[model samples]
Target: MSYKIIVDGIQHKFSSAHFIVGHDKCGRLHGHNFHVAVEFGGPLDPRYNFVVDFIDVKNAIKAEVDKLDHRILIPTASKDLVLKESKDNLDFTFSGKRYSVPRDDVCLLPLPAVTSELLAKHFHDVLSQRFKGFKIKVRIGETSSTFAEYGE
Candidate 1:
């Protein structure tokens, strides 16, 4: 019998960019209780007789998202600013406005913004690298009522 298991991860993000300017510098610094759910599909493992080990999946997925657990996630390749990384902090600047984030509590992703779709793809890509035994889908949510999923 084909078996499958779905695991979900939760995080919080303070983001405000969406390719279209609305509000000010990300709609006045908003936050979201982001929820990420990953669904794995495939036959049971030969050794464990399961599609995937839950702990293994958890570790892999967590490793990717734990970066954004409770922080301001931003793009590392933005032309309108620069990130000055120190030993324990990062200075994000835009038009002379500086946003300082603790190095231990911030994530600099290679994205233009922390949108739902990009967040999904980001997790999917990371997990795909660690878990190639089964297909997966990563879901990112702005709230309990809004979310997005990405995978093969």
Candidate 2:
């Protein structure tokens, strides 16, 4: 039989800023109180009788989200963005507008856009690698009511 362990709470959230490349209002720099939840699915280990320990999953999730907390999320793979890196700042231009943010306050993500949908997928890919024997699902909320999910 298959079982799933789900984790989500106040500790699983981060606040970050990002802008969509071609979006109208979203293209303007803004931030969100983003929340993340994860589900791990697989047969329970005979020894533990649980899919995995809650602390293990919690710690992994916290580590990932903590890196993004209170930072600007920059997408490195977007074809519409031009980036210039300096020792102190990341200068990026999108849709004819230029912005320079401090390197220390930014998290560079290997994604085309820093949307909730892609963020969920990025979490799924990373967490799945950490827990190989399970099917992973990631759900990310950009706001209290708006959410996006990824994984099988």
Candidate 3:
């Protein structure tokens, strides 16, 4: 039988700023206290009697969140946005507007957009890479009422 483990806690959270390149309203740069929940599903290991250890899962999720904390997120694949990098800073131009930030404070993601849907998929991909042979689900958002989920 297949078993599943879910990890969602205060520790699986990150705060970051981002903007949609062509959005009408949300195009303006904004930040969110984003939370993540991960579900791992697979057949239980006969020796361990569990699909995976909860602490190990939590640590993996925390490590991913740590990379986005307190940073400005940019979609590296956004067609409407352009990114220029320097040794000390990163420059972004989106929808005819320009912004710049220190290289140390940015998280340039290989995503097409910075919306919650893509963010969920990005997290899913990250976790999938770290933990192989297990079905995974990643949900991310600013609040309980509004979120996006991705799974495989």
Best by lDDT: 2
* Candidate 1 C-alpha lDDT tens digits along 50-86: 8888888887766665567666777675666578999
**How much is the lDDT of residue 113 in candidate 2?**
98
Any runs in candidate 2 off by more than 4 Å, and if so which? none
Better of 2 and 3 by lDDT: 2
Whole-model Cα lDDT of every candidate shown, in order: 0.72, 0.92, 0.89
Candidates in order: C-alpha RMSD to true structure:
3.7, 0.8, 1.1
Off by over 4 Å in 3: none
Clash totals for all models, in order? 2, 0, 0
TM-score head-to-head 1 vs 3, winner: 3
Per-residue lDDT of 1-152 in model 3, one digit per residue for the tens? 78899887466889999888888888999999999988999999889999998888888888889999999999999888889999999999988898988999999899989888999999889888988999999889677678888996
Q: Which prediction has more favorable TM-score, 2 or 3?
A: 2
- For candidate 3, the TM-score is 0.95
What is the lDDT for 7 in model 1? 82
Backbone clashes counted, model 2 = 0
